[model samples]
Target: MADSEQREGMHYLESLPRRWVTLYIPLLLFLFFLLFPFYWMGLTAFKPNAELLSTEDNPFWVVAPTLEHFKKLFIDTSYPSWMWNTIIISVVSTFLSLAASVFAAYAIERLRFKGSHQIGLAIFLAYLVPPSILFIPLATMIFHLGIFDTRWALILTYPTFLIPFCTWLLMGYFRSIPFELEECALIDGATRWQILTRIVLPLAVPGLISAGIFAFTLSWNEFIYALTFVSASENKTVPVGVITELVEGDVYHWGSLMAGALVGSLPVAIMYSFFVEYYVAGMTGAVKE
Candidate 1:
């Protein structure tokens, strides 16, 4: 009776069919749900318009794929410009936010000053303040500063949200590092800047990578600020340009739109592919460990 009772809850699936039913089936379903959109987008981007508009063909697979949509996207539109703007904005804002975050997080975590914990909490609270609440005021500020229609507006405004998030994330990472190392450096006549530069930074690479990825992703996808601050089509980022420019009144350019989305998403995907190791480490709380 004891043996049977223990086996009831603890026994693992012993048969191949049982494991397949319990594990592989669920995983396949989850993957289909997650990846179906990308697959559809790619299919639409390559499908000829006649085939796309036709109802008789199997929508699941493209009967014939062509590069016409891509050709139109690059040759007939300002996709290249939007791509450049997004890349510039995402990269510049990410670096700016990461730099400020590293300093702020180090000060908050290691400087050991009064109300440091309170300050950290305040930063987290600030991040919780949604962009919807902030955009109107930020619009006024951007207009007043005469940067409302330029890439600089996005580059500058993005840091407002990015800093708090990166700072909060890095604060936890910095706290995870040993304080004894800092103390030893101090005793050895190392200045605060030297310790931060030489000791802390090396250990914090994974955290920094994680923060950079977050900042970059947010800046790339931020729509409210981009739509509000930048009105010029030429200066628009991919998110705004793709949605706004591709739609004309009731007519939507589905093929071109899908192409833009597929192209626009490639940079972020590439970035993740390159830094996935550090990002996974950071999320798993394993930096410098």
Candidate 2:
């Protein structure tokens, strides 16, 4: 009975008020910190130019909302094309990266090849190398390949960063699965390919979704390579297109820019909302020896 009372006290942090102070308040603050930027973007997206520029009005609240900015974004610019390019590149590159990462992760984690530890570490280190430095060489390759200024340039280049990180992440998740499953399949005369597709892939859905979400988010927001490689306005992805094309020399379209940014971010937000549970599980899961 003493132990039970202690456990109950611990479970609720000794009282409701203390629990709310420690847990609920911190969580609310974290949510505000994380979500406030998006909220501000939405507010700015809807506020008219007059209200936005006015010094007298409450800056935090939008007194009036207009869709003119969104209308201008879609009708007056190449934003639709940019949106399409972003979607295509993000999806194609995400799938390509996920596929390559899966195979690489399986090989590194399951194959137990010589120097596998070092190779795995090397792959992760490659992910840590800044894109700012790599884009110079990558730009040269894109030019030499004659794919510069095309959507293919970004689709191809994104995997350079995406694959390594996804591979490292998936390697950990794959390690969480039992070797006995694969061993049992092997004993039943299953080929390596069969074991991978039939046994491993099915169980690794959460990890795969997590990796795909990561790859997609990175590809969607990638700016450096996109800017360096694509010169044409129509070929530019949302991140580059929204920022570069919306501004005239010495002039910025604040309203349209905010609208574009808000719209551009919705897809990623929706993707996360859909797979958040799986992504959390995938990140937290680990193997126990």
Candidate 3:
């Protein structure tokens, strides 16, 4: 009986390696799949045009490393203007969305106004509505407003989607906070506005930060609206500008395109890396409620 028990234990121990292999093999493969494109882009960014156009089987390694592509992008192209336009639009839209969402969230979460819950649900549902459905009407509105073919068109359009979802996310987060803290502040003769600004907002800092980061990244990486609304070359955002204008016909400027893409992605990557923990905590807190 003891020998049988020992054999069973040994079998369980031996199965551990198999279980690990089963779990990790798929994960490793998925990681490789996701990473290979970015790796290839990075490699191609460093390669010269000669290497890029070479009909070589393994174009993964740079034959001659050079900053020439980056130089050309900055010096020869209107990339700087496009980048500046993207920055302004993204920053402005993100800030507006964050401000609007926070206040709306606070009101919905804390105030016992009539139909607040229904309103929250309705707003969230509205956000979930497909952009394709609204783009035509939105474009018509933009034309009537006389902001067509301008970056302001994108700035105005973006907040319509961003504000609602961000408000809902933050409403959930804010509801998770204990009412006892607010009650204590009330006892100390604090007004609702004061309490929100001084007490509640500080405690919900992680959630606010997470919402801000989401808004910023979304606005920054937006391509569809930028493409549809703005037609002027100088007013194009990075994503649309690079892909559309850079490569003409079959003459793909692979190295410069890769370099531009890499540079454009850096800000978003850094923002995510820096605020990742806060973002996770915010989402977790929202879920727990």
Candidate 4:
């Protein structure tokens, strides 16, 4: 029996190297593919415009590094206004979405109201409708409301979809939480609002963060609606402003464009990195429970 066990252990040890190699090869390749664009963007951001345009200069290596592009982007252009507009719209819209979704979700998930389940389903289905189809009608509404070409247009329009998806996500997460906790609080004479604010909201932090991050990123990177609603340069978001204003009449400002994109994406990247674990945990917990 000892000899047989020793042989089995040796076989398992030999198989480990093969299994590790198979797993690592694909993982390394995937990482490379995912990160190469970021690497390219960083290198391009520092490269001089001449080097950027020249085929002789290595695309991966910056021969002549300069801050001229960044200077031009910040000082010589309207990038600051664009960035500010994007930040305000994204933050406000995300906050509004969170506030609306949490209460709506709690109602749908906990309160036994008539047609609550149907309403939840309908909201989720409406979220599934693509923005491409809705943008025209939305544009008309924005125009009618006289908010076209303004940042408030984005703030108002973003929540229409964000609220629905966030509501559904929060509903799932809220349902996963045990009702016994709320029941205990209710027995102690806590009002529904008190229980929600004191207990439920605190417990649902992970889901809230995930939902907020999603909403913020969506609002920040949204291009189609930004383009359709805002025509003025001062009111444009980062995504639309960078593409339209930077690249005019085939004179593409590659270095500045890449720099702008890199900077624009940093906030979302930082947000995701901070809340990534919570986002995964919240989603998994909601699904499993």
Residue range 1-289, candidate 2, lDDT tens digits: 9988976675843688987998899999999999998889999999999998899999999987999999999999999999999999999999999999999999999998999889998997887788999899988998999998998998998998999878988898789899999999999999999999999999988788878887788888899998899988899899999989999998888889999999999998898889888656545542211
What are the candidates' C-alpha RMSDs? 4.6, 3.4, 5.3, 4.6
Clashing pairs in 1: none
lDDT (10s digit) by residue, model 1, range 83-167: 9999999899999999999999999999968998899889888878999999999999999999989999999999999998888
* Candidate 3 C-alpha lDDT tens digits along 18-59: 866886788899999999988988888899877777896467
lDDT of each: 0.89, 0.88, 0.84, 0.86
**Which stretches of model 4 miss by more than 4 angstroms?**
1-21, 281-289
Q: Which of candidates 2 and 3 is the stronger one according to lDDT?
A: 2
Local error of candidate 3 at 239, Å? 0.6
Q: Rank the candidates by lDDT, best first.
A: 1, 2, 4, 3
Alpha carbon lDDT of residue 227, candidate 3?
83
Lowest-scoring 10 consecutive residues by lDDT in candidate 4?
A: 280-289
Where in model 2 is the C-alpha error above 4 Å?
Answer: 1-33, 281-289
The sequence of per-residue lDDT tens digits that candidate 4 reaches over residues 130-182 is: 88898999999998999889888889888988898788788877877899999
